[model samples]
Target: MAQDRALLRVEREEVLGYLLLDSATVKGDSVRYEGRNANSHNDVDAIRGIVRSQVLAQRMERDGIDPKRVAAFARFPLEMHTQRIDDKGRDRGVQLGLIFLGYAVALLLYMMIVIYGQAIMRSVLEEKTTRVAEVVVSSVNTDILLAGKILGVGLVAITQVLSWVVLSIAAMKYGAQYIFGEQVQAAAVATAAGSPGAGGSPGLGLLAVGLPPVPLWATVALFLCFVLGFIFYASLFAAVGAMVNSQEDVQQAATPVMLLLVSSVIFMGPIMANPGSAMARTMSMLPTSAPIIMPLRITLVPVPWIEVVGALAGVAAACAASIWLSGRIYRVGLLMYGKKPSLGELARWIKYAR
Candidate 1:
């Protein structure tokens, strides 16, 4: 009965017996066993099973019988070990930070494109509405006038963007410590070290959480994409402005372009989930969607250098083509303004402008 008892305390590779007999003497009924396991908790069952088998063999030997014949021989003993569940390469904080950065870049680009694009539209409309375009047309070529408007507004957008970036970086470096407090900062560091489930919630007040470092190359790529994207869409906005006679007609003219822009943003989630998917890759290559999708993909996956260069080339070509086509519409539409022209008349204007 004593040898059959399985539960025993393990100390320094020795098994201590829990049962005491009426004879006031201790017997070595429990068996000692060694196991190859990293975690002591996982070795508990293995140790107990192995020790029980050994104790039975010892009892058989003590009873003047062959222990090997009487004892159970396992062809394959069951072993259990805990495998590491977390991927060391997958840093959640860094991943989240990269995603947030990409989202911020995409958002800022969208806002700037829409804001400055509309500004160009309104500027063109104001000049045409006041008959200033007529006087200005004498001195400026229509292509050059349109190009100048895009360039001027584009420069202002660039300035505002740079100022915001500088301020944001400065705030992250200098102001975060003062705002978040030392305790929250410590908690942030502790959480990032992989004990997130062990304790209290860090909450949204952890301002000192470390963000993944933004690669310099990504910044350069983002800037180039923003410029090219702005020019491409701004050309269309200018064309829309020329087509419409008044602000009331602007919404109707601008809806298609705005919808296209909005759709690119809407596809952001799918792009992030499967950056290597065909749909994401195709969208990243397109000039209209590339600006938003490519940046988001960059933060999450490795985009080939050739793809980046190819997308840029595609966007540049599209921008040039847009400027040419829009310039034609803008030239003819700016002067004739009693009512908005139909699609047939706009097509005629394009041929005549050529």
Candidate 2:
């Protein structure tokens, strides 16, 4: 029994020695091994390589452990530390600009889609009811006619958004003195204390506020995303308008789509409030919800580069899918003139193109 106990202890010690060389599970003493057999050799080789590269001789002479090894284990790599600083700076800037731009762009998009979408619906109904659509259809292909109308109206909507953005920026710049009087005064006071005559100097406070600034790049990216998102939704709206013969019918069809947009927007608010939340992460990846969610995410969260790339890719794919679906509906709904189609008929439209 004593001999058996001694043999088991020896075996355990040998096992421990082998495992101590394993990079994955080399931490202190361990009871259970938890690594794959496949990469064990490679991991061991890597650990050996790291140990070899470490200047242990210099470490013994200088600080007992090589400064490089100490840094490697105790502190982040210099490149990584620099990158972290850069990232923090970027995140701070993004946080400031994102809040301002997200709200502004969201409000503008909501207004434009609602207003111009209604116009498209009304125009479609009027054209069809007055038999004007029939005349136009005779002269031009339905597809071309529909594309032209959507493009023309979309261009107008784009113009309105641009105008609003410009006017809003101008108003904020000129009206800051009136709107934020106390804050500006406090800033000026702080500035004067630091540099006595700096107060009376022209553009001193303005310089303090930061010039050639205002997150223009972030705003541009947000606007481009908004435009793409709008195109995706508006195309569906146009199709729905084509399907319905009258204003009342269009309203019924438009309700679902509008509700979806509203729900996406509402969902965006929560995501903005906690951009790092799991729900926000999931929603941002979804193409249908991404347009609304991504901007909000940019505002509240530090979205990883990979996530941004993946989300944009998903949005592009979804846009392609939406376009395909919209084309089918547009093609079928353009020729139909009577009662509105049922859900079943819509299903048939999917197969119409197929």
Candidate 3:
């Protein structure tokens, strides 16, 4: 009976924010109602605007006045899209593809780090809890063990990602027209209004608007970013697993790392709106967020070679630092038991451990 109150955590579930009220019309031209959705104010406001327009047109028609002229004057929506030019003075849908390509790649990197990082933590914790590490260490060096766990998992992850990338490339190259259909074709034409006569190419519509030439350099940079950034975060996760005494303590230990990861995604909209801003550049340069942010900048515009090298270098430095620190904690913590160590103890491990 004491076990009946156990709590079970579930994954692949999340709550979405929503606000809705039953609207009522008390009287003509005097109806009042209020509702808001914190997650999507634009959609809610668009609904309100559509309703208001309908009401205004109906009331004006009843008063022997045509609202068409006023509606035309109001100009329901001013349709427009951005104009993106590459360093090569090219805009044949490359920049448009770059927009989504950058966003998708960054998001994938974020998810990979979080997901695989937790997997490493869980693996470390399981071994430590079951006394497997004690026996394993008798035959193997701790540094080698740590490196093996990281590289093994990282290799599998990179392989899976490469498979997905190949499939996506094939899909975009061949089956894109059927997948996107007529709406995307119309949208491609609409977006072409900014550049004029660009969408007139026969049989290329959405493909021309969606995918771009992914250069070899960008591909190499992306691979390096994924490997280095993953190792950097994965080491920290392995340390957290070693530091904690139980599953209950794991959340608290990993919270700071999770927050660091999540913060990088929050500024994406603002960064895309102004890719060349100082905030974007700073994030791109910082080792903590460079994996995701730097890829975003690379895809958004023509970033300088120096900035790219600096960002990659920063990630490499971070990877080395985290690996070193985690190794120190891991070697001692795996053998120590009974309770979690304090911050001072972790510092001492780094400073004094052989």
Candidate 4:
């Protein structure tokens, strides 16, 4: 404490805070180091790696253990290569950005799907409750009404998504200039131009070396995915809204459909981290998750053409199925009122409704 105080005075530095290790023990390869979370986690982590290792080594030598033998207990430096995943030479900053980007895109897509899906449902419920559907169904087809509602709501979402894409790109460009300076930006641009498919990083040219923008192709793909994905979910929302007699029942009926949407987000962290693993590939293909999951791979890396095609096909088919089932329910449920229908009845509606 005296030496630290003297050093602080000599260096003309102010004491901010201090850390005191609570406990440490070493006995025959059994090592324990206790720390408080109030200290930064990095500090605690570093203690385990550096400080504890040093203490263990010194104690081992004091106990007459060979220095090399004590050193042998240090954590081994290991390299692992995962199948089909390439992270070589990618800057940590770029990797972090990709992770964040995937998460952001996924969060945005999920919100839009849920928000607008419920919006479509609410609109349907309003129509049904107001007896507007009874009047409209007299002329306009329910399937047509459902499609039109989805299209209208989906178009608004697309406009917002496109605007965000454009602004984000512009902001990222300016951010690179502000952060990395013009020379680095120019160099990145040059690298990106020279390398075909570098957009997989969706970054500035060799932007991984700097900072990257999402590629134009990925933006296009994102728009298309959201469109079809919205249709897939929105149809179900419309169906749920049509089935329930009152607003109280709306949420209860919607819960199961909402669960499917929620389930997609559960795998996001793992999918974004692996992106090429079987889990990622499978999630990206399933209609329930593909809307958000496929975009992650589309933006981060170049997925195989076959996988991309298959993923889109699966989502498209799911959309068709959802529309078909929802349309049938909408046809029957729009008129039937009073009590909430059971799962069995809903199935019968699907089976028998023209």
Cα lDDT of candidate 3 equals 0.72
lDDT of 4 by residue, 222-319 (tens): 77788889999999999999999888999998998888888888887766655656887888899988998998777555566688778888999999
The models' CA-based lDDT, in order, is 0.70, 0.59, 0.72, 0.69
- Candidate 4 has which clashing residue pairs, if any? 192-205, 199-202, 202-213, 203-212, 203-213, 204-212
lDDT of 2 at 10: 35
TM-score for each predicted model, relative to the true structure: 0.71, 0.64, 0.73, 0.67
**Model 1 worst lDDT window (10 residues):** 81-90
Candidate rank order under lDDT:
3, 1, 4, 2
What lDDT tens digits, residue by residue, belong to model 3 across residues 92-140?
5534466668888999999899999899999999999999999999999
TM-score of 1: 0.71
Return the lDDT, model 2, position 19. Answer: 22
Which stretch of 10 consecutive residues in model 2 shows the poorest summed lDDT? Answer: 77-86
Best by TM-score: 3
User: How many residue pairs clash in model 3?
Assistant: 0
- After best superposition, candidate 3 residue 82: deviation in angstroms? 4.4
RMSD of every prediction? 16.0, 16.8, 15.7, 14.5
